[model samples]
Target: MNFALGFKTTMGESGSMEALEKQLICPICLEMFTKPVVILPCQHNLCRKCASDVFQASNPLWQTRGSTTVSTGGRFRCPSCRHEVVLDRHGVFGLQRNLLVENIIDIYKQESKRPLQPKAEQQQLMCEEHEEEKINIYCLTCETPTCSMCKVFGAHKNCEVAPLQTIYNRQKTELGDGIAILVAGNDRVQAVISQMEDVCRTIEVRITEVHLPKAQL
Candidate 1:
């Protein structure tokens, strides 16, 4: 009975992790989302590079169809939903990065590296330089975790350090703000594309109206 329960628990954990990894896969690359993942107006996600490639591939529309819809930029259909995405002069650079997804990927990688250990056998990280001291602070200059002893009287004496929790909080706040700003920027870009498309449609109608009177004669 005990063996069966343990086996089921392990299997459940593995399944959840696999499911999450599947969610992060990029449709264009058929791989996990890389850095600078961007969310389309359609709420679909793609790597920025892959999005740029798709947008570039779509440039032929402007030349072949002479699509006057967007004079300055281009558009592409979303792979997941077939929704169209129009860009500005900045192209993919104007796309909002899905930083939340990126943070999840980073966390997944870090968690994967750590092996599960039984509570009784869990180990503490000790400083290599001060073998007797536990690594309790992070060195800002060297970007390493070190022991208290290192800060006061060791090689890291000249370096600055911070509590690990403080660094974690600061980074979290910064990323949160970035994600919010990017999301807003994305909405505005979409709005601009939509407005340009409308303008093009109106121009086409006016041209047709002028030609219609001549055709009647």
Candidate 2:
């Protein structure tokens, strides 16, 4: 799927919104990420559940159906970059959640939920090739937005096409799930920031106390 989000002004072609959307999809499930999305050591993100599955599959004991279970500290390769990832005692739970990705997902969901005005829809519905035609079809093969004329006579004439509405609905659902994941990530980041701020405050106070004694002397 062209996971790109497009922006059209009733008369303009969609921008790179579709491209941005694609980045949020999990390679393992081929869907938008779920809650507790983990950033692997290689910097690739995966849904926590998907990471757990990969970790289990990599274990010889798990594959043989042996009664012995490996500790969460086992290692697994990243599904995307194939980088080796060593988990902590909590396994995938020990991996850092990507707050930035989660925040973008939340913003996208909010924007998606907003009803587009008739004027805005008209501005965003036009095709780049057929300026007069609204984008009514999605080219499944090429993963591009197309006007009816494009389907009949343009480059996508021989390609598989689906109604734009269907794709739109599906993308909306994916965005909704993304929002949930982002919320959890945001909380995790906030906690860390808070802890770091407290540590900094303590160090500042200690430094001030040490300096005060020297100045008094």
Name the weakest run of 10 consecutive residues (lDDT summed) in model 1. Answer: 62-71
Q: Assess every candidate by TM-score.
A: 0.44, 0.45
Model 2 lDDT-worst window of ten: 6-15
Candidate 2, residue 4: Cα displacement in angstroms equals 19
The sequence of per-residue lDDT tens digits that candidate 2 reaches over residues 1-217 is 2222332322122234456668889999999888778888888999889998998788644332254334536788888978888876566667899886876677666555656445453556788899999899899999988989999999999999999989989989999999989999999999999999999999998888888866575
Candidate 1 is scored at a TM of 0.44
Candidate 1 residue lDDT tens string, 1-217: 5743443354345456677789889999999998999999998999998997888788754332343344467889999999999887667777999987997787666555656544544467899988999888889999988889999999889999998668778889999999999999999999999999999999998888888877574
Show where candidate 1 strays beyond 4 Å: 1-12, 60-71, 116-217
For model 1, what is the alpha-carbon lDDT of residue 161? 96
Name model 2 segments beyond 4 Å from true: 1-14, 60-72, 116-217
- Candidate 1's displacement at residue 102, Å, is 0.7
